[model samples]
Target: MKRFLAYIHRLIFILFLVSLNGCKEKKANILPEVSVSNKQKKQVVYQVFTRLFGNTNSNNKPWGTLEENGVGKFNDFTDKALKEIKDLGVTHVWYTGVPHHNVITDYTKYGISNDDPDVVKGRAGSPYAVKDYYNVNPDLAVNIENRLQEFKALVDRTHLAGLQVIIDIVPNHVARNYQSLTNPKGVEDFGASDDKSKVYDVNNNFYYNPKETFKVPVWEPDYSPLGKENHLLEDHEFDENPAKWTGNGSQLSQPHANDWYETVKINYGISPDGKKDFEELPAGFENENYKKHAEFWNDKTVPNSWKKFKDIALYWIAFGVDGFRYDMAEMVPVEFWSYMNSNIKMKNPDAFLMAEVYNPNLYRDYIKKGKIDYLYDKVQLYDTLKHVMQGYGKTDNIPPIQEGLKDIEHHMLHFLENHDEQRIASIEFAGSAEKGKPAMVVSATISTSPTMLYFGQELGESAEEDAGFGKPSRTSIFDYIGVPHLQRWVNDKQFDGGQSTENEKALRDFYKRLLNVTINSSALAGNYQDIHLFNRKNTKNYNDKILSFVRWSADEKLIVVSNFDADTNQKFQLKIPQDIVTSWQLKTGSYLVKDELYDTFSSQFVIKNGEGTIAISLKALESVILKIQKI
Candidate 1:
């Protein structure tokens, strides 16, 4: 009996041990291989301004047809450029301004509007000034569906080369001379005026003066605000006004009246009478003339133009884009986006929707309330770049940048540059192009956001001009050949031209390394829990220079230290917690070294108790990343 009892006890103990081992293994696997959904994974986005990037083998001048200007053909972009981008291993390609329009001519061809003087002297109008949201720019392709299919083929090729595709969607206004002005699809769906009562008012039917109307102004601002209404007047005032102006005046007419900005207003509402109704909530319409324009957002059933928005959304996805970048999200209704999001997910969940939201205050709300999948993190990009270019200063309050990373899985679409903002390099370099390249590269890469690169960013097109309304002005940096020109100059000169020549190569490599780390390391892909800030006290001395932090998951850990200072080297030590000390490897640049390994660094370095501190001999405005891992 005693022997039998002993045998039973031994069997029970063995079972208990096996169960414990299984649980441990499950936990380990869970932490190491969290399935990164389409939304969660890091994306390398390449922005393309369609007209600027095509093969242009056809006899199209800058101002010619979309086919001539480089829209439909996938092979228009340079092989070298594509090779470099493919080499960089970009995950997605976002083409801006591919949608077609007849009313909105490319800038280079527009009969120069004197009123909107900021319109580039030799311009191709921006894609944002949409003639029709559903159609591709005829200049870009023939039939809308065909154009999209051709574009999708490019995306497939991109995928063949290992990348995805995202396109732009303008949720706001349509082109100045859209065919729908008289007979809108949504209005037709809502049952247009059976009485055939079309009221023609100079103020409502046509473009208007800026002072009287709220239509987003196209004319050069007569007076510019300096901080707070400090005005900067234009050198020459435009004679042609859009309000009183008629189609007979020119192909693209401005409202002749000087009272308001002339652009077709969107009507989000309808009266029971089947007449148009618009809404500007806080400010009701005082003038009968402006009431028709007010018909844009007045329909209660629609809720801020949502009903019509659904059709537009359907049109694009049907056109075949994997994702969309929603323009000016804050101004639009949040419920509309939320509704659209649910519908889009129902139809195609993988579709990406990135919102243009500037304020950090709205980040959480947009995600929670608006159902926005991704938003640009301007503050993070700005502060980090400032630190790298200038040095640490009191201006660097990193709380927002830090707080932003907390729920980044849903809230963050990391970006250094996009269409609406200044070029990342321009911000870092400012007037001296020489100093900008290296600092911009290092700061942009190490910030560690799901990076978005605007068109021409890789080669070096500075965001130097004012992105005026409608015009593809100088402020925009979608110039495709700009980089090629730089490449040519560099090859011809055989010199970095007194700039940090390595900046470009370093940036390219940094991106490659960062992406490899993101795709390969389970640590970066998992939840960014256990975040700690360390050795950042001397912010004033370094001003914009030094930033260091630690991010870890159950399976891995990393200590990222960066020097934003352009002039001096930053040295800092970390008192790592004893629990996480022993199993760590040091990664410098792209190379990984075991803590036990010894080597000479041009700068100083040491590790103790698994706590490694670095004294970097940084070059002018360079960024260094120390990737620590536990075995």
Candidate 2:
């Protein structure tokens, strides 16, 4: 009997070995592919301003031609930037402003040119002033196709290095001088007789009384001047009074006098005349003129403006690009995105899409509908940076920040500084090395969604005080522009163009550590958990100086605390379940855990009974991550 039993056991062991070998063979045959499902994955995006970060072998003149500029070929990006980003192991690269936009100067008085481009007006123009939506700007690229192709090749390289590439697109308006789309008689322009449906009289009143439509110039809501001094308000007419047009032939006649910006408003059943309340037309389309225009693009026979956009989308996707950072997405109809989304995904799914709209109220509907993938978390970012830099703790104003960091179902675009904002480097902060920055960086990266960092941010680039108020303050990323320290570091024989400033280095390290932790953490990676505010009413604790939160899943947990306060130290305690104490690993700045720890007392203990309280000491302006793992 014993002999028979031993024979059976031997047979079972042989079977197990065969199965193991078969598994290995299967693993070798299959290639790894990105997840196609909507699994909650964390992504790290590195934003680049292609104009900067030059090649070492070429002439390194400041902002010169493509050759003299040192970037080599247009598609051929400098190895310096690529190598640095590749080494960091980021997920994607968002190249901001590669398109050409009209450059307009506004020197109006009373305009707050003190802030960055997004806030104040009456200054330099934005990349939003797109001259051509389909063409790449030659100023930024060497061989147009080569530059773009090479960039795509770089994307391939990045993917081989485990990263994606996303380019920016301006959908709202084009350059005032972009004749391709703006020329009154251009093939793409909306002509009164040529594309009747594309142009429409805002209200039904136009049909009942043709005189009203003919007499009134579209009265858009203009806030540019306070009266007339603000060129942006007057020129853009983003929001004007009467909110509707009074007459077509009226003196205000859509205010065509403003030449600094081009691109006229489209009447998509909204308002062109600005006289009456605008409402949607009936099913068959009550207005024949607008219908005629929509047909231009909607028509299967003609390749209209919308078709041009679709072709552009297809072109980039084929170029191996991963996504788009749409400029002025709010102004473009959601229907346009819905159509593009369906068609583009057929070619490349998981393509990251980020819109520039900062308002959730306006964008939430489309986002929920999946018309867009993400949007800039400008509102929360601005609040957090301002509060933290001021040495203030988390206040009531920061719940949106916490909510953004915790919620995962809908992702919010995160960034400390972009081409549009004031540089965070310009702000001074008080705190311990580990406390303040770690919290902010961790929150930005490990919170609810993916985040991005502008080109010079890692090197601490500051913009001019009276910088192009609304226009991009075109600066090169060669390290020497205004930041001497960064230039010195990059010029050092050992400088690989990847090291961080003393403060930025610490922040970068913290971000890397946080990323590793996030990557390894399933709970934090997807939409499996929720964030709970620990001490909400602790206004004193909620000082604009500090931020804190707890993230948890059914079987996992983590606590993040940060003190944006630059001057004062604060102490806090985090609660832990009895079982977590035994398996917890404290993840700190760029550090990883290699070994396991054990406690023999009990598999679990009672926290309320003095068993699982972890004391936290946060220095002025510092951040920490307490990671509790479950086995």
Candidate 3:
């Protein structure tokens, strides 16, 4: 009886051990619940000119036609290409030139109207001058009749590859010949129901000059439409009986040659006399959240333009577009943005809304009141960085701009190059792609804001081709030309760097490493302190040409330093402020300091008497991200 009782006890103990192991295994497989704020990854936007991204054509003729300088189709962004893009550490892909614009190509067979060369910016046309709001560009489709479906498929592929899609929403203007053929049943076109006799009305979609006739702008001495190509409609006359206000707010019947002649301004109930026809938001509406602000506009009697834009935005959102890049957002009123963006959030709470608003005074108003996700950090950070890259500005200018916008720093998106800016590798900008390396490091790591990269910027594209309507030093958004550096990386549809030069390959590899670190590091999204100012005052050999800063979170700490000097190799003892040392809770000892970007270098970080210091040796236009942990 005693032996049987002992055996039962041993069996019970073994069962208990098995049950405990099972619980342990279950707990190991379940991920811990992370807070929403802690799960936020730094966004990296890859903005590609859609038509130029896949064109393998090496023939880049000036004023080239679609057949001569081949255009990339929606089918060009194959699964392999998108996967390569995703591998570059991109979260969002801004596909520019996706909407239907007034291209000077004949597509009458597909029920699309031909655009006069006189009214188009180039043979391909300006993407900002949207011609049809309801259709995709026919020039970008494998089959002209299936353009919209092809775009939709591209959107699906982007989503499947774990990236979001962003396209343009030019709210301030439309093509001079604006027309929409596929409006959803009951919607009327702009100006279709307007009373053209009045200069401004509450419901008019445009501002008019009553009985004045419209005339095309005078051509420059050496330039003409399509490089003086003879066309049937190139008679230098358009058929508008009454002139409307030019896109740049010129009230004259004939705008200047530099004006936005291919487009017309969209009126959002703001009259020529500066009186608003729509009801303004209540004074305290700026302090409200999007849901509350949306409720405020639900019952308000808004203008026809407001409803039209709201419908247009919601349509895209429903069509699986992740967000919009609003062109010239500041040109529109803040109240209109509040109304438009609020409705957008109601449809998709995660829709990313970035805009181009260069005025610093209006940044907060656009962000807090307008509910814009991001505004171009151009006038402040970008301009400062440009001057520094050109060898005139100091690193000290960066901290003040950062301090000024500290309250809303996350909403300021940073970039070294974009479609509107000069390429970093261009002779007019930095003169060499290697010169941009340190600047890009600082731009990507200096803030918790998102970073944007132009398509060929990674491969050191100089934009040296003077493609007809577009000049040198800037990639042509107006012309259908293949980018040389980008095509090499495309490598004849293999989507590999097979044809890239060794220097170009090295540059791209550096970009891949930097961007991956930017997205994965938690310290980058945390607290920041500028050690550049402190080091400049304390450390010997530390000059204004080098910038250093510290970023830290609970789990990680980083010291980022960059030498912007193009001719001198810098060696200095970079110091961290005593306050930061205390904040990081470092005891007087040595810590392991290793470079997170490149593994070729090693150093030691020592703490003594509540101060931290590290030896830094950086070559010209070189940067290092040293991560430290207790030894």
Best-performing candidate as measured by TM-score = 3
lDDT of 1 by residue, 205-271 (tens): 2323433322223444453211122112222233333322222122123332322122244433333
Off by over 4 Å in 2: 1-39, 55-80, 100-125, 143-152, 179-304, 400-409, 427-439, 464-504, 527-533, 536-544, 553-556, 576-606, 610-612, 629-631
Better of 1 and 3 by TM-score: 3
Q: Each prediction's Cα lDDT score?
A: 0.44, 0.45, 0.86
Q: Compute each candidate's TM-score over C-alphas.
A: 0.64, 0.64, 0.94
lDDT of 3: 0.86
Question: Candidate 1: misplaced stretches above 4 Å?
Answer: 1-40, 55-74, 78-83, 101-122, 142-149, 180-263, 269-304, 379-384, 387-396, 408-410, 425-449, 463-507, 527-533, 538-544, 572-617
| Residue 202 lDDT, candidate 2, scale 0-100 | 33
Q: How far is candidate 3 from the true structure (C-alpha RMSD, Å)?
A: 15.6
Better of 2 and 3 by TM-score: 3
CA shift of 617, model 1, Å: 4.2
CA lDDT of 457 in candidate 3?
Answer: 94
Writing each residue's lDDT as its tens digit, candidate 3 over 1-631 gives: 2123334443543343344433312211111222225677688999999999999998999999999999998889999999988888899999999989999889999988889887789889999989988888998999999899999999999999999999999988888788998899888888888899999887888888988998988998877899857888888898776888877667878888778888888899898878988778778877899999899889999888888889999989999999999998888989999999999999999999999887666889999899999998887778778879999978866665665566788899999999888998899998898988988999999878999999999999999998999999999999989899999999998889999999999999999999999999888887677777678778999998999887777777889999999999999888877888777788898888888888877788888888888989998888999998644
Compare the candidates by lDDT and give the number of the best one: 3
